[model samples]
Target: MILGLSKHPSDESIVEGILAGGRKEHEALVALYKKFHVSLERFIIHRSTGRDYAKQPEDIIWEAIEAFVVNVKKGSFTLKDATLETYLKSICKNLWFRYISQEASREERQNKYMAEWDKLEDDVSDMLIEKENWENYINLVNKLGKNCKQILDMRLIEGLSMQEISQKLIANGTFENDQTVRNAKSKCLKKIMELITSNHQ
Candidate 1:
């Protein structure tokens, strides 16, 4: 029988079943967790810096899902523009920001940085490559917010300038000014960097 974290016996009938947690509903939700929980956990785990925090990514995911269901029940949140999958990803990232301290050890991370650097064959390939270097980076970049992807695509990828990125952000209603776009871009890049380095092996 399935053991550990008790099963939520219902499917993700988010409106009724999840909000109304009887035995039948709860078990179904538990099964949902079993099905996707490990994948969600793996995403978060890849952001940690050590085994200590590696195991905690799932804890964060479960807590976030519970909180999401609660807020939806209370009408404090809605999935107007976001799909269920997108909503879940947001929760995962928010949890990382909220509980980052509990998620990783600094020394373990520093050692990892030393290793990535020590192993780097050349500078050209460190950030770009005809090699295996950019696989992880590309995947991580692919996971960014829509606005981020566009900005990077235009300015960094498509050879547009920061001014053009700002213009695009404004046109897309993501910002009212260039400074806001720049700041947002900086924050997004920082997040990407943090995720990339957090739990490197």
Candidate 2:
């Protein structure tokens, strides 16, 4: 109806046209967007309201559309028994869930770090109560060369995995593989820990 097809095309036909990779593909995508975009936006807005960590509804909707298109083209979406809208909505839901999970993890890490900071204060007493030692440790970490600092920051502060860090480093020509990143991380951490322990005594 939307695309002016003589009759309603099957989901398979539409998907095939999209995967065909030409002007037909472009028309298919436009047709899909016109058919679903408003409903998808409304659905996302309804679901994300009042959630502080939720992504902007527009962003979520657009990302969902992009994921859906890419996944469909890549054959990841089979569209076996479900309607296209249903499949798209499921993708949006999964994306929202991922966002929520990451937000929760970030908050949890922050709370844990805060509790550890308090304990460090108690353990060190007034001798280092002003957090001078903590500052010094930060300084030592900063002195550990740029790549080491970047690796540690990405892994610890950003909660990225070793493999992700390795890819980033490799892209920047820092090191070739995850093993190199791991070795560098271990060496940097050991150096910092040794510095702290020796200075504490």
**Which model scores highest in lDDT?**
2
Candidate lDDT (C-alpha), each: 0.62, 0.71
Off by over 4 Å in 2: 1-16, 74-80, 121-125, 128-201
The sequence of per-residue lDDT tens digits that candidate 1 reaches over residues 1-201 is 322233432223443555556763465456656656777777777776655544377678788788777776687765574655567767887887667754346557756854553343123234444435456656766788777667655644576766887887798788999877766766556555565556363
How many clashes show up per model?
Answer: 15, 0
RMSD of each: 19.6, 9.5
TM-scores for candidates 1 onward, in order: 0.39, 0.51
- lDDT (Cα, 0-100) at 88 in candidate 2: 85
Clashing pairs in 2: none
Full-model lDDT, candidate 2: 0.71
